[model samples]
Target: MPVVSNPLRALAGALISVLAVSGCQTLDDAGRVIGRADLVNDLAARLDRSTELTYSADYQLPGGRNASISQSQDPLRAAYTYPGGKLTVTADATTACDTSTRKPTCTVTAPQAANAEPSVAIFADMRKRGLVAPPVVVGLLTAAALDPDATIRQYDTTVAGRHATCVEVDQLSDAETAAFDACITGEGALGSFTGTVDGTELEVALSRYRDAVQSGAFDLPAGAGLIDRRADGQPPA
Candidate 1:
């Protein structure tokens, strides 16, 4: 499949790849050990315990276009709202892709629409069409921490009036000499992430976090014009 060039997904995939190559003992800036495998373990535990989460961030793209993104996550469901479009992927692997503006409403059904895990379905749909989408900053961080080669070191920092641990990924590429920074809260939830791509700097900060999701957030709006991808034999956009 041809690689899709969605800037956000590309950035996420790159960050994840870098973290995958790095080690696990977290440390302070002074080189003193804070905890062994703290970053990895905390992220894992949080994801396992939380039934729902919400993330909101503003993104500055390479061309200087600004975007605001909001995401809601549930056990086997997720919804992304950005600009004029909204996408909801249900636990059954059904994706309702809708745009409030010019685009048409569409539904794409995955092969495992009935039996697969929600996370599995969501991830697969995100990666379909060669797109490397990470549903939220927390999701990306959790995935990176789970990588066998991931080595995350922590430094002290503050974000949004909250004390945080800054986890860094250095040496992403020899030519670029760039580092990725993800600041996480004491409970391992994502606070913010900052990195540069193609000379454009991007930063995402979590403005809100929740432990429960509203059932209606995952439903397609009433009276929406629906285009079934399966019936039309069309590709997902």
Candidate 2:
């Protein structure tokens, strides 16, 4: 199969690759480990806990009996359509509450959506609620700053009537572009290099500068943006 260029997926894959490289480094940056032991403890604490959430809707039938419909937030839990009677929910490890005594405090707040996924809104809500740890933003920004060879470019384009931010290498050489595409296409070994971090020689995969451009994914967005943003001799919008 041709390598599908999903920027979000690609970014996620890159983040996972960073984690796979060094457990310690991954914890320090991505996992938010104040200490190795603390990190281990946190993971251990979450190992056995379970969480479950279900949204239910009720309807009144011609008879006295009522009908109930429900959906579970648990990813592992399969959805089922049941008779108009009762909906039972059991907590799972992924979505369980933090405490046992109190009612499962897993709260769900639906955000007003206008084009973005509800998950994105939920993430924004979590940020507002101080429920999510801001790690990746710090990590990527830090990587961009500390890493001198970092190349970042902003390409805004419409996709399926929605605007998207396509991040890619700013000024890529032909050879670099080829290598990047090859890496993503699985044609060759993903790029890597050695660098001195804190005086220790560290082998780190070189960020693929060309991967985002390989094939038609890069061109389509570029062309669309050009056409959409073109106002030949007019003031910018």
102-197 in candidate 2: lDDT tens per residue? 222322222222333212222232222112111222223224322334444434443223332333332222232211110011111112212222
In order, the Cα lDDT scores of the candidates are: 0.46, 0.24
Q: Give the Cα error of residue 152 in candidate 1, in Å.
A: 5.2
**Model 1 root-mean-square deviation:** 9.2
Work out the TM-score per prediction: 0.51, 0.19
Note each model's CA RMSD in angstroms.
9.2, 23.8
User: What does candidate 2 score in Cα RMSD to the true structure?
Assistant: 23.8
Q: What residue pairs clash in candidate 1, if any at all?
A: 22-151, 23-151
The Cα error of candidate 2 at residue 182, in Å, is 17
Q: Which stretches of candidate 2 lie above 4 Å from their native place? A: 1-91, 94-142, 170-237
